[model samples]
Target: MHKQSVFSFISQLIWVYILLFSAVSFSQKLTSGFKHTNALINETSPYLLQHAHNLVNWQPWSEAAFEQAKSQNKLVIVSIGYSSCHWCHVMEEETFSQEDVAQVMNENFINIKVDREERPDVDQVYMTAVQLIQGRVGWPLNVIVLPNGKPLYGGTYQTKTDWIKLLNSLSKTYKEQPEKTTEFANRIAAGIQEKNEFGTEKGSVFFSKELLNTNITTLKENWDLTYGGLKGQQKFMLPANINFLLDYVILSNDAQAKKYIKLSLNNMALRGVYDHVEGGFFRYSVDTKWQLPHFEKMLYDNAQLLSVYANAYKVFKNPLYKERIEETYQFLNTIFKSKKR
Candidate 1:
């Protein structure tokens, strides 16, 4: 009886020690040194607040940030993203949180973080710049701009090593080749501000079935014959492309186009791009076979896909298309209901 009592006493003492140690460790973490917050600390945006404690000295999208960049004569890095972007979170954790990366960015650039959801005007200008410069755009959109906010260079997510190297290279070039850099920035600014000239020439525009069929035939050359979408390693189920083809097939009664549409739809539904368990489609597939998804469920993509499948079922009467339509409707309804809750 005495030995049992002694064992219980010792167990209680060990538990007390563990609790005390945990408390001390937590307290030390809280008070060891004051963790610095950036200019995003006071922002009401959820996406901006996500980076409040980042070591990169991130500033909210403000005129003050631009003024500071002008005063310092440093290139401004405007990085844009939303709260739910997977790549944005990845860059935050892998690239922005690092001490060395923060050191270079803080010293050389006036870094600005923008929640694309909050300030779509800012997002639109830089997105246009990135698309014009790189021929494509995606988040987290990182654009290096002059003090006046004209984009110089832009890209999506970069690894820590590539990011640091690019920053150093750009800073060096900007410092040593200021004239050339300004000229390039001016050219990009012109491109962004350039108006669309297509179909603006003074001429009588003519539309004919032959021209439409010819264009469709040319577009088919880009389609993947084997796996069924556009010939690319990464496939985005762009519903616009699919819907246009569907319209053509319906009006023209083109047998080959109908076959291609069925092939593409079947592969998309069967592949990993469509979540068999979850009843929604992924944003895109990383592989040509559509066997691997990027795993970001975008509501817009799924909604468009639902419409495409519904229209497809009306024409093809494929039971799979009908099933997918019902499933996707349920998925969207569930999401909306949850948001209300």
Candidate 2:
């Protein structure tokens, strides 16, 4: 009984020390020696609040921010990411927190921090712009918008060195060749508008097994026999379509489809992108081997992934798929779920 009491007392002391250290660390992070005034301090979104103490002059997305951009004749730098985004946090630490980077941002651009979850309308607009420009889209989506709120240029994550150079180059271009910038923004804005245009849609089409077979053939042709994902350099999660294919193939008992699904899932599961240290998957692998990830953990991506893994488990009875589903949700509950939920 005496020994039990001593162990309990030690555990209690350890817990107390942990609590105190956590509080002090959090307090110091919020009220650090370095400070700057920015509009994100007044925002309620957790993503915005994360940047409240950033040395960069980060204003929340609002009419006021655009108005300030218009008045100052400055380009608006829209940095779009959600609160749980890993690379977003990385950029915050390596770039936004740096004095030199912040100085460039504060002087040249009216920087706006957007929580994609909070302002999905704005995110949709800019993501389309990014797609139109670069032919692809992903977060840490950085878009340089004109003073009139036109997205002139957009891309995903960048290193601090490349980011600084891009900032300098874009700023100089904006100053020297204003017309070219306006023309590009005009084209992008038009493309964004055209994105929703499905002019004169076909009323109906007859479904056929032949059509399905042809589609599966296309997938099989491009399917990487060795690496498992689509035959490409990139490794987008591509869950919805892949999941649908898996279900259809299983229903039809197509051996080729089954082979493709198993290979893709196995490759993705046995990779670095699955976050072996944690319980979730990252945005995508940069290589065909699924080794390097962009490291953003969006809820939508995880949800889609969960559905895919759950279906795979249901069909194949694979223990790996079951574990992936369980661990993914564990990640969501532990890191992504807010107190409000």
Candidate 3:
């Protein structure tokens, strides 16, 4: 036990050292063939590092960034996305890298790039507002807000032309008709506040097996037998859904449930989406049978999956489950240790 604790201590120290070195490496601006530098140069997030040399005046989400917008009476352009997001990278290359689009964004909007993993609270608030307006929310989530910090307009990835058009239109609408824009902001803010009013919501008086059984029944209804996930896998949230079912399996001890769990685990681990070359999972399997994949290695995905597999190993002492947990841990400990503040 003491040896295990010592090994853990050394492992953590090594991780810390790696993160510190990485932060220092990312601090230097990459100057090869870049159009210009921006405020993102001062940021620590790996996602922000990817945008440090963009022509857009990209600032990390901060009190100072918002204050600068307020003082200049400029609208805020909050772009929230994570490091491993494919669409976010696409938008960066297509729109933010373009000279014309960057000029408009810099001139009219205080553009802020947020790592959603780093600031989920900020993401939650603005994403809620985006959902309120657009009826959905997604990565590369671009939200335009008033100088006073109320959301005005929000959308996911737009074409370069469309983004330029949006920047111009919102700037115009905001300047020329302050009253209309203010009304819109007020309405959106109110809606966001209302949706967020879950503070007073009652919790269950007590836990019950009946409630668990009901949820398990819902799971059974949703289960895709052709594929292993709860639903047909255009995308897979295996860690969240499968991990929960694992607890249900242990609690119920249903023979069928155990078989299903094993089936799901084996398919996910053996599938192309599981990253045979790498030690982590792709974001999801694009195909229903987990053949094709969306290859983005998210920290949360690997982190949650590590827990799920680790728990599975603990219970069943399965060699496959143990191997998965070890591999996933290695992947996360190596790649996701960014120096984001």
Candidate 4:
């Protein structure tokens, strides 16, 4: 080879080696955090093990923690989150990992950490309250409950400063205003009882075709045609409404309604929310175009979305919709089906 050609060949070889080394370095960094240990070392779930060594005296979800709070006459702080949650990890590092914050928590509150996945019953009860109280719900839920387990306040992740201030303020209020706290708790308990009583009695309303049309119009107002689906970023399927749209389009032969339904389904199916590698829909899309996912797949969401897509296919005779239905079914069969029996 000519001298210049030989030099060029050597340069290409060096570039290839550099690329390989960079790849290995990135992989090492990703795995390096895996070596750290926490109080969760012996815990059953990988999520719990990930938090084993935090400064906060973290206790697993147990009756003992609740009992201790009651006996100590301390308020209970229940922090609920899952492993895949990015905010959960941030809160742990910023708030739970701080010595002063942990000190305040240890001195004034009986803190309990719960993996929402492991104890979904607990998560549901509190999450319901979070929605009722805050008019919304999300991960890294922080709820402060009375000794008797009645939640007084709830919020999502907080900055270290905000969390510390809130904890101190609550502690002071609980200490100085015992009578007021009792009165407030009694009112909340009564409200819950009244709500339960009301929920038990179902009132039936006569439905008409007009009412159905009104619902479809309302959904259309929220629909996003440019990116597909309804609402802004952090898009959810709203399967109930989608099924209604499918029914409306088939019954009324409305082309515009059918177009919107197709747009929503195709956007979700093609985006990261569909989990191209894993073959199941994620919890929700974090972006307007449904390109990024929160990555926690729920069985219920899959089941509901599967039914919607299957119905769409049955009505439209569209192979694309049929393919989505089949793929979702296969995911359920392969991942969720149990052989325990």
Best by lDDT: 1
251: Cα error in model 4, Å: 4.5
Which residue runs of candidate 1 sit more than 4 Å off their true CA positions? 1-34, 195-211
Give the better candidate number (1 or 3) by lDDT. Answer: 1
TM per candidate comes to: 0.85, 0.76, 0.71, 0.75
Off by over 4 Å in 4: 1-46, 83-86, 180-191, 202-217, 248-256, 331-341
Best by TM-score: 1
Residue 272 Cα positional deviation in candidate 3, in Å, after optimal superposition: 0.8
To one decimal, what is the Cα RMSD in angstroms of model 1 from the true structure? 10.3
Candidate 1 per-residue lDDT, tens place, 204-305, comes to 999998999789989899888788888988988889889998888888898888888998999999999998986889899999999999988988898899
Task: Decide which is better by lDDT, 2 or 4.
Answer: 2
Off by over 4 Å in 2: 1-32, 199-202, 205-221, 232-234, 247-254, 270-287, 290-298, 313-341
lDDT of 4 at 323: 83
How many Å off is the CA of 142 in candidate 3?
Answer: 2.2
What overall lDDT goes with each candidate model? Answer: 0.90, 0.87, 0.83, 0.82
lDDT of 2 at 240: 85
lDDT of 3 by residue, 1-341 (tens): 69999999999999999999987776543554566888787777999989988889888888898899989999999999988789999999998998899889888889889999899998888989989898977799889988777899999989999989888998998889989999989999999888878565788666687887887888788776665776753858567777777787777787767777777777888888788775888888888887788888777778888888887777678898888777877777766666572
Off by over 4 Å in 3: 1-34, 42-46, 62-64, 71-73, 82-85, 115-121, 131-138, 168-180, 194-222, 230-233, 252-260, 313-319, 329-341
